[model samples]
Target: MITILMGSIAIGLSLGVLGSGGSILTVPVLAYGLGQTEKQAIASALLIVGLISSVSSFSGIRQRLVHWPLVWLFGLPGMVGTYLGAWFASFTTGIVQMTVFATVMLAAAWRMFKPSKAAPETRSEPSNWLTGFQGLLVGVLTGFVGVGGGFLIVPALVLLSGLAMRTAVATSLVIIVMNSFIGFLKYQQVLTESQTQLNWHIIMVMTAIGIAGSLTGQRLSGRLPQQKIKSAFSIFLILMAGFILYQSLPALFPAFTL
Candidate 1:
């Protein structure tokens, strides 16, 4: 329980500071730290991340940082894709899911490490069809891995939609909240008997702490350079990806470790 709490603080801080890594870490914390099965961890992660993101997004909305039109354009298809992805995840093994998740983390880290070439003033409105397609793909990946998919969304918005970095981050939160809630709902329907009984006490504590951490992260964001933060976060994600692959692949192929 202490370990889970500590891990939750890290998750919250990452989310608050980076606006994306909370969901990515939640599953590992639940599964490794709390002794939960992968499916249960995934379900719990969706709910936790959804609630945290919902709280975080209000600030963006209040500041008019969120692009309302893009929210609807990107979110509706994302919701559908989230539901479908959760349904598909129900049939997969833990090792398989973790393997795929680790692969995605690696890809995200690589993207983050690359220098951005986007010009702040170069705004281009992406077609609705392209935006919707991107959203759907992100949502599916999010549902499958129980992540917010902000890493993917932020980049897509900047590169495809040509939104500024701050706007993209804010907009990503709105889409994450939607996808996470829908994914949680779909995940619930397929829960096993063991998975049905969740540790609400832990979850509530984590949520509260996470919210506080996110608020702190928001404050820190003002003091920190975005490029520095991204660089550091990219390194962290690379390490995490390696750890996950190491843990999951051995389970999938026992002889590999032998």
Candidate 2:
């Protein structure tokens, strides 16, 4: 319980400080701490992350940092894509899902190591279409692997939606909430089909602690050296990714594992 509580704080703090990585943290907490199967963990992660991001994004909305035009331009299609991906996951094995998830963790680590500093985006008919298409792709990855897609969405907003970095980050949060909740609904159906009783206790605890932790982290973000923090966290992500891959691979390729 202590470990789970600690992990919950870390999950929300990571997002509050970094504006991403909450989903990355949530799954392991549920899977390893709560002894949930991968699919269950993934399902739980979506809710936890969605709740935390809602709080964080609310701040941005209050500040008027969000770009509403971009939210609709990208998010509505993303909801559809997320649903498609979650549906696909129903046919997949946990090992297969975890393997893909570990791979995505490495990508997220790389993103943290080299965060985007893109020029302001250009809006046009063709570019708008491209942005929506990219949203679909990112949404699929999010729903399939249970990530927030913020790392991917932030960059896309900068390069494709003509948003300032702050606005892009804020807008990405809204989009994540939109896409993630739809994904969560689909995954719940998956859980129901598998006869799993979704654990609301841990979810509620994690969500509550996570929100408070995020508030603390936001306060601390101003005091801390951000790049150094993200650098260290990225290395931690790499190690965790490696561990996830190691755990899943032996079961996947038994003959080659040794």
Candidate 3:
């Protein structure tokens, strides 16, 4: 229990500092630390990520950092995609889900390691069609992997929609909240009684600790050099991805392992 709480706090801190990665960590924490099945971990992660992002978003809303128009354009279609992805996830095997999730972590780490481009001086809103398409793609990934997808959404908003980095980060939180909630609902539709009971226990403890850690992380973000932090985090993700692949592949292909 203590270890799980510590892991949850780490997950929240990642989100607070990077505005991403929390959901990415949550699945592993729940699965390995708490002994949840992949599907159970994914479902629980969606709820935790959604609630944490929603709470974190209030600060952005207060500062007027969020772009409302972008949220509407990107979030509605994302909800639909999230639902579809969650439905598809229900039929997948545990090893298959973990393997896909590890792949996503590798992709995210690669993106993080790349040099960040400067934001455009003159911003223009992305076309509705373009925003919707990106949102749908991100949402599907989020639902499938139980991640918030902020790592993807933040860059898309900056490059595709021409949002400033700050605005993009804030706006991505809103999209994540929408995607996570919808995905969680869909995932929950197939949960067993035992899973529900275990999830409840996990959720209550993790959410409380996670929220507290997020607040602490927000404070630290102001003082820390963000690029250095992101670099370190990217390396951590790469290591985690390797570990996940090593653990999951054997189960996925036992004969090949021999």
Kindly provide the TM-score of model 1 when superposed on the true structure, using C-alpha atoms.
Answer: 0.93
lDDT of 2 by residue, 1-258 (tens): 897789989987887777778888888778877789999999988988898889888988999999998899889889888999999999999889899999999988898888556664444644777878888988898899899898788877776656777787778888888988999999999999889977999899999999988878877877887778878888998998888888899998887574
Give the worst 10-residue stretch by lDDT in candidate 3. 190-199
Give the total clashing residue pairs for model 2. 0
Q: TM-scores, in order shown?
A: 0.93, 0.94, 0.94
Name the 10 consecutive residues with the lowest summed lDDT in model 1: 192-201
lDDT of candidate model 1 versus the reference = 0.83
Candidate 1 C-alpha lDDT tens digits along 87-180: 8988788789888988887887887778865845656677899889988988899888888898888888878877877788789889999999
The 10-residue segment with the lowest total lDDT in model 2: 117-126
The segments of candidate 1 whose C-alpha lies over 4 angstroms from its true place after superposition are 120-124, 192-195
Error of 2 at 12 (Å): 0.9
Q: Which stretches of candidate 3 lie over 4 Å from their true place?
A: 122-125, 193-197
Models, CA RMSD each: 1.8, 1.8, 1.8
What are the per-residue Cα lDDT tens digits for candidate 3 across 201-236? 779789888888887887787788888778888899
In candidate 3, position 181 carries an lDDT of 98
Q: Is 1 or 2 the stronger prediction by lDDT? A: 2
For model 1 the local lDDT of residue 89 reads 89
